[model samples]
Target: MKSRHIKAQITSFCFILPALTVLALLLLYPVVTSVFYSFTSKHLIKADYEFVFFKNYIAVLTDPDFWTSFLTNIKWTITSLFFQIVVGFLAALAVDRIRKGKSFFRTILIIPWAFPSIVIALSWKWILNGVSGFLPNILVKMGIVDTVPQFLSSANLAFPVLVMINVWFGAPLIMVNVLSALQTVPRDQYEAAQVDGASPLQSFLHITLPHIRIVMGLLIVLRTIWIFNSFDMIYLITGGGPAGLTQTVPIYAYNVGWGLKMLGRSSAVTVLLLIFLLMVCMLYFRILNKWEKEA
Candidate 1:
């Protein structure tokens, strides 16, 4: 019997070994290579390279552009995450209350999240374009402004507009996840609260919040990392233009590696991002663990 059990275990490991190998190649290999290159004088196109021993890290840390992009990344992550959670949670609540056509409404609500990032970015770009755009032309016809709104160009409006677009794109995902978590909360608890004469707000504060808190916490952590590392939407829409007002760390790294051909410095920038995000995730997981204990 013991020999049979050992054979079963070996068979299971054999089944998963190929997946593990692929994972290591796809994820670990690039990460290890990036870390190794970060300490060297690697260039994007040049063949000659040598160890620089932290010079790349120092250069990236001292550059003012890097700091600016870091700050912009923080703001972008926080604002986009805040709105995504609120709007998503509210929408989930609204949809959950619907007695009829719940599936239809849920499907319609998640349509924004169904498209690829490229599609979303290009669609929004055309809609908000300064000339010959639907939204700008409609606003002008309505006499909202004398001139067409440069939603993606004006420095003041660019960051906020991107945040709004991100929220629109991301909230639906939050809604779907939160809605699933909401379904798992037993209906008896709410019914008991109602029988005890609890107000809707009171029941929500006492019961609903606790039940979905962990899911929301996990969502926040994942979304924070994703939004911070996000490149496609902003790159496709604005290309981090208008005086670099919308530039984030990923774009900064791209500019360093591709535009300036400083692969070593770009690797250093990515390493720093990895360190920061790991720290953030650690903090989030600590809080999540505490919540789990409380539960």
Candidate 2:
């Protein structure tokens, strides 16, 4: 029996070994290399990388562009996550308790999320384009704005448009998850509360919100991290343009590494981003764990 158990453990390890090896090579190795590079002067064409311990990091920390991205990320993260969670919850509520064909509507709405991100971004770009587009034309027809609204072209307007697109794509996940969680909440509780003369709002606040509060928190944290590291929509729409006003941390890193070939600087930025995300993940998981314990 002992021999068979040992053989089973060994067999399992053997099965895991291939995946472990691939993970080490593809994920761990790149991470280790990036951490090493973040502290050095690892230029693109340099034959020898001089160990300039923390020089790249110092540059990154002190750069104005870094601060810009940090601020933009903060704003984007908060506003986008707010809308995504609120809108998604409302959508889930509507779908979970509704008339006939609500499930079909739910499926149809999630189709935006299923669409390719680049396609969505570029399609919005055309809609917001200055020269003869549906978005500007409608606003002009409605007499809302005397002009085309300058969504993509203007720095002030570009970020909001990007956020709108992101929220549109991202809200569906939260909606689906919240809808599923709502299904698990006891219908008997809702009925009992109703019989006790509890108003709909009171029932929701006292019963529904408490039951799903942890899931809501989880969704908020997930959305925050997702929006914080978002790259594609803004990149596809503006390419971090209009004089770099819309460059988030990810796009900034991309520009530094691929565009300018500043490998070490870009690596430092990537390291910082990873660290920030790690902290957020820890907080999120801890909250979820506590909720589990309480439940």
Candidate 3:
């Protein structure tokens, strides 16, 4: 019997080995290669030099453009996360509580999330343009402004618009997540609270909120990490334009290698962003661990 159990374990390992090997080749190898390249100058001309230690890193750190881009990334992450969670929670509650047309409304609401981000950005671009655009035209008609809004060109206008666009596109995902979490909640808990003379608000605060605390916390971490590394929406919207007002670390990384043709500095930026992302994830994980323990 022991021999048979050992053989079964070995056969299972054999079956899983191929997938493990492929992941090592595709994911692990590239990550290791990138880390190695970060230490050296992989320039286009003159014999590529050996490890430059931290020179490229130092240069990337001191660069003005890097700081500008870093700030843009922070603004995008904070604003988008704040609004997305609130909006998604509200949407989830609305959809879950509705007796009529819940499925129809949910299907319509998730359309933005289903559409490719490039298409959404392009569509919004046309809408927000100062000239003959849908949004600006509507704003003009509402008498909110004297003339059409110049969002695409103005540095101030561009960032907020990007945040709003991001919220529209990404918040649906969180809504769906929360909606799924809501269904698992036992009705008896709410009923018990009501029997105890708890107000609707009190029942929601104590019962509904605690039951889904894990889901909300997980989504917060997920959104934070996602927005930090996000590239497409911002890229297609402003291309980090209007005097680099909307550039992030991803854009900065692209400009470093492709724009300046300096592979070393660009690689440095890539490594830095990766490290920063990992740190943010770790911090979130630590907080999440504590939060879950308490929950």
Task: Indicate which candidate wins on lDDT.
Answer: 1
Of candidates 2 and 1, the better by TM-score: 1
Give the alpha carbon lDDT tens digit for every residue of 79-164 in model 2.
88888888888999999888898979898879878978789977887887787889898999999989778888787888788788
Candidate 1's C-alpha runs over 4 A off are 1-6
Which tens-of-lDDT digit does each residue in 1-295 have in candidate 3? 9999999999999999999999999988987877777788877465666888888989999998898899889888999999998898899999998899999989999999887878988899888878979989998899999888898889778888888999998889999999999998899998998899999899889888888988888888888989988988878888888788889999888887777877777888988898988898898889889878897
Preferred candidate (lDDT higher): 1 or 3: 1
TM-score rank order: 1, 2, 3
Give the top-scoring candidate (TM-score).
1
* True-structure Cα RMSD, model 3: 2.0
Task: Give RMSD (Å) of candidate 1 vs. truth.
Answer: 1.3
Ranking by lDDT: 1, 3, 2
The parts of candidate 3 lying over 4 Å away from their true place are 1-7, 44-49
Error of 1 at 93 (Å): 0.3
Model 2 scores a C-alpha lDDT of: 0.87
Higher-ranked by TM-score: 1 or 3: 1
Error of 3 at 136 (Å): 1.0
